[model samples]
Target chain A: MARLVTLVESGGPGVREVASALAPYAGHAQVIGLTGSPGVGKSTTTTALVAAYRREGKKVGVLAIDPSSPFSGGAILGDRIRMQEHATDPGVYIRSMSSRGHLGGLSATTPQAVRVLDGVGCDVILVETVGVGQAEVDIASLADTTLVLLAPGMGDGIQAVKAGILEIADVFVINKADRDGADHTLRDIRSMMALVTREPNEWRQPIVKTVAHKTEGLEELLEAIGKHHSWLAEHGELQRRRTARASAEITAIALGLLRARLDVTDELASAVAAGEMDPYAAADRLLG
Target chain B: MARLVTLVESGGPGVREVASALAPYAGHAQVIGLTGSPGVGKSTTTTALVAAYRREGKKVGVLAIDPSSPFSGGAILGDRIRMQEHATDPGVYIRSMSSRGHLGGLSATTPQAVRVLDGVGCDVILVETVGVGQAEVDIASLADTTLVLLAPGMGDGIQAVKAGILEIADVFVINKADRDGADHTLRDIRSMMALVTREPNEWRQPIVKTVAHKTEGLEELLEAIGKHHSWLAEHGELQRRRTARASAEITAIALGLLRARLDVTDELASAVAAGEMDPYAAADRLLG
Candidate 1:
């Protein structure tokens, strides 16, 4: 909208341009996060969503977060290899990023990466994090609407242990619906959701069952996302959530960089070498 | 043991004395990290190891890192709960820490927690990380030896995508040995191990088979850990690894604290409100 595409393509620039350029439609686009255990057909679900959105003439962006190779500091970069069918479509943009050895969550570049897609004029950004159970819930903090995808037969308490993810879902998608125990997963999620009380103004968490690979329930999934987004907007909760996420953005960036700096300090080196310090001590000293 | 029990009581304060007290057997105690996907019986394997170690008259300490509840900032603490049988034993000590939203792998207090145990005169400190997958590989840098546990049927190539975990494994344990596809998993690991050229003086990654809960094949597992220790010492790799991990401990500590800080920022609140930021952005901005 602001000739932002040209500015962003100019080598390297501040992210503010990207953020501000994309700010106008920030509320218009439906940004949904999809996360679940590995082998849960997350990719298939994403593909169907892309097709569904495009069928409606809506532009979409898919930011797939893959696991990074610790040795090379690059993403395993396999998801793209398989999802090349949409590579030539102008209405869709797919970008892959390595979680970059980030143990507890997604990479530091994820937000700016999402902003890049936003600046590119996507009406929807489907951010997918790697399958790491609860820790992968980091996506919920950034997404306007968060969806936790689960397959059938993931076991009872296993879902409960994912406190990291359970607390954040606006919608729970029981994907691979054709599989056995899909209903059980749905019921389990509903039971879990029932235990979690939404904020006074927040919408009730919805559970939808879908066979993502077949596009069996893409319409219902889309509807659920739409319902959640609109609910937030009507209650003005959308604006409140996004602002809090932005401030979190500043703190996350500040800490990530500072941590990288402290990771390479001389004192830390001497301490480890002398056997006089541990990570816990180094943390205190580094923060101090 | 330098009255190391007092240090464990004070938590953080006991790290120095514990490290010093453990220094005498630092070379002898083999700190092995066990991690893998959920349902892989990491706790069962840890339990089996403790039993085996105790039978040999060796004291073992287990530091089980569980996913913490964001609301209460406390662990659901499932690992230890499942490990109740060992709770009443005098020779075995178990401590649990919640991720408490620390994204660099373990919680801010984890390293200190590990140190507290190290000082308590335990011969071995077994750290069980919340194994959602590769993101939890930070344990490799914490333990002197690391075992990346995998199950039989995670689908082909799933492990290949796990570059982070694979690179860090001093040993690989394919647990649930009696499962139908156990052989395939064993072969997969061996083949993957073959892909990398072993370091000149370091030990090759060994894949061991075990059914942990049944206490089956644990002797071989302990043998592997012991052999790995001997290999490290014989090759000077143990000291080298410890030195490296020590430095990582400091850096990860700094990052852990920073992560903790960002987790609670007003900015996060704003971003969540505005829908402009997600946790990935929050975490990234915190890092940046």
Candidate 2:
């Protein structure tokens, strides 16, 4: 599985052949995405959830997508230390992918990585995105269920809504609930969600509180996840979401292939540089 | 000019014809880029540069690339007010571009906007990027001369070094030079630059002090920019940079073209979603 993940990440030659070999046995695992800002206990919650899912006699796969810039220190080292607890378990497989240099970003390799774990024998797959910004939205679109984490005083619900993070939440997990202002945070979130109009049949994202350090509220979080999964299956939303994610993944791969084959010659570049030809015309000529 | 810029920004039909028409005039403008962290007096310095350039009877164009998210009130509103002083000047063409929703980002439209200004007879084009991150690097590649701005006590030279911003500087301007720790900031930047080994004939970035509000050091800043421009021309690096920028621009347009034409059918999406075909294989099939 690690070898397969590495091959996909490298995006080198023979990647398609390997992916084709593994394609037959996938589509069984449930993909759950967890994401939040740093210091939101995402790693801890992911660890806790892994253990909970393991206790259910289920095999699990973990894909931790890191989006930190090359300059900033990434959280993967700390994650590896925490995940060492499950490293000896043959049934649990965990992988970390850095999306720093890839032009297609997460879409190019992440879905392929997920498909690898799904193909192998994992029953539940947890995709935890490290860091903030666009990675959250990407993970949300790619997963069957997305859990957006928040802590007290992180930001009020108004700020989250304005940031457009709330729109990606299938479920909201308020980690560090034992900290001060937890109630205030809950009220803020509730009030913000109230402002958005939804139909009667829409799924209301349940807010679950957890002190991941103490493993408190672990069972309730799992139950909420299970309920959401049930709702997805019942409404045929599962098929729709999986297909949508697949479409995006395929498009990104196609775009990457196109980028690689773009024939930009220095003569053409010189024309554009010399103001004898515009970029739009140069592109047309390149294709021509 | 305003209509042309708007059409390019929209990235709609008639773009190719518009671009082909303007392509012949783009190579004339001496493109200059100025960037810095927020609160570093970038706008004041830019305004000062414009006024000083106008005093020389030079026609100037300003393309302020705003990378701020929608949730945060961008510096554009403030920039427009500062630029109003130049609004009535027939010799100046000033436009603000927001890189918020465009899938191709600044690459898709900024070059076209610059081309329009260049085609319409602007002598000196100032490309000032509002805010930080990748936008700074983007503007650096697009300009003939790049000026990275800093202020006292924002971050020690070490943080700047760590941020990798120093590599993009052709000239450094320490704005707010009247503030305390001005000398310290200069020393920090100097020390950081000194650590990097440069070729004997390579251009050494000169650090200039500026109290932009009072218009102090404006002449020295302009002189340093002129020196760098001369160096770029004499060393054949100006053409290199322009061609490199053009190549990236052309490639972005090509990729945008390929993405638009990718044939991802619903049947193909379903197969990949069901794991009967991997995303990589699906992409190949779509292209094939």
Candidate 3:
């Protein structure tokens, strides 16, 4: 499993071979994406959810995408401490990935990693990301079920809406539910949801409240996720979402390869910099 | 000016015309990028900088990229209110752009807009972004000078370092200098900078303190920017940076066009989804 993940991350010729070999066994596992702002207890919630899934005798895999650097050691350490409960469970597999200074590396490597986990016979895969940037939104495209977590006093509702997080959330988890103004956060989300027009037959997102550190509301959160999965299967949205994900993955890989193949000459760059060549014309030359 | 911005935003045939027409006149303006986390008073600093530049009798243009949605109207309103001082000045042009759900859209259109401003003979161009994600880092590539702002209690130093903001920042500003712990923030950044190795003759990054709301430290910030600009010029780094920027811009445009041209068939998507076609092979097929 570690070797397969290394292959995917390397983005070498081995990736194609590994992906092809795993392709047949993929799509069996349910992929769930959990995203929320920092300090919202995403790690705690993720730990709780993993346990809840384990209680049902399901094998689970986790991929935590950490955007922070190793130098900022506290947050990553906290994640490890929260997730250590599952360390001895053979049914659970967990991995953390750092961005490694590449802007879109998380989006580029995550799908292949998920495919490897799926092929390895995980009953469910939870992909967790800090809800900050485009990378978090990319997780929505990859997941069959996406949970957007929020908490009172996180100043997240309007900010989340502005970031377009509301559109991607299938289940809105208001974590830290015991906090003051948790109800206000819940109401804020519901009213925001009301602003979004959806067809009558479309799935209405459910709000699940959780005090994740206390392991509260884990069952309902799991149930909401299960319900969303069932809805996707019933409406054929599962196939549609997977197809779109595949399309995006293929395009990203193709573009990366093309960029590598395209020899961007210093001469061309200098000419453009000197204003002797237009960028469009230079682009044409590069394409040729 | 508005029409040119619209044309660039449209990403139509007219973009090439606009870009080519402006290409020759570009490189004269000192493009400065100001980035920091939200509530760090990026807008306040930008307003102060604009006023300082205007006092220098330099024509200035501001491109404020708001990744948030228009529905979250308060933040945008705050930007407008802060920048209202320059609303009637013909020498100053300020425009706010939202991400509109397009990843890297700011990177895509910002250069063209800057070119338009440069063509009109602006002496300086200020690009302000909420220093959150990859997009803000992309601003570094496009700017001649990059200023990173931090507040006393913003918890930004470590986060900024993790985001790779420290590497890109040419000038570090500890804003809200009158606030408690401002000196600690300044000391923290200085200590962090101490860790990065640089050549003896390399331009050392300067830490500037500013209470932007009071318009204090404006002169020193402007002077630091001027010093960086001069250093880039003297060291021949200016041409090198622009060449890289143009190269990236051209490549991004070329790849965007290629993606548009690549015909993604539902059959290919389904085959990949079904595990019959490997994504790399599918990418090659789409390319062919």
Best by DockQ: 3
- Across residues B1-288, which tens digit of lDDT does each residue of candidate 1 receive? 223433432345555545554533333346888877667888888888888888889888887776434333334667677778888888888876555543545634455556556655678889887554333656777788888888888646633566656667888888888999999888777776778786686567778888888877788887888898888888877777766666665665566555555445675545533545543445554444
| CA deviation > 4 Å runs, candidate 1 | A1-28, A68-78, A101-104, A131-135, A157-160, A197-200, A263-288, B1-29, B67-78, B133-135, B157-160, B255-288
| Candidate 2 structure quality by residue, lDDT tens digits, A223-277 | 9999999999999999999898899889888878877788799999999988788
Please give, for residues B22-102, the per-residue lDDT of candidate 2 as tens digits.
887778889999888656888788899999999999999998766533223232365767778999999988877765432
- Model 1 agreement with the true structure over A1-288: per-residue lDDT tens digits: 223432332214555445554544444456789877676778888888888888999999887876434344335556666667787898888776555544345535566566556655789989886545333556787788988888887645732556656677788888888988987777777776778776786577878889987888888999999888888889877777666555544555566556546645665655654555544555576677
| Candidate achieving higher lDDT, 2 or 3 | 3
**lDDT (tens digit, per residue) of candidate 3 on A183-285:** 9998888888888898999999999999998888988998899899999999999999999988887877777777787777899988887777778888899
Please give the C-alpha DockQ score of model 3: 0.45
Candidate 2, residue A20: the lDDT equals: 85
lDDT of 3 by residue, B220-272 (tens): 99889999999999999999999988888778778777767777789998898
Over 4 Å off, model 3:
A68-78, A99-106, A156-163, B68-78, B100-105, B156-163
Name the weakest run of 10 consecutive residues (lDDT summed) in model 2 chain A: A67-76
Between prediction 2 and prediction 3, the one with superior TM-score is 3
The TM-scores of all predictions, comma-separated, are: 0.82, 0.78, 0.93
Predicted structure 3, TM vs. truth:
0.93
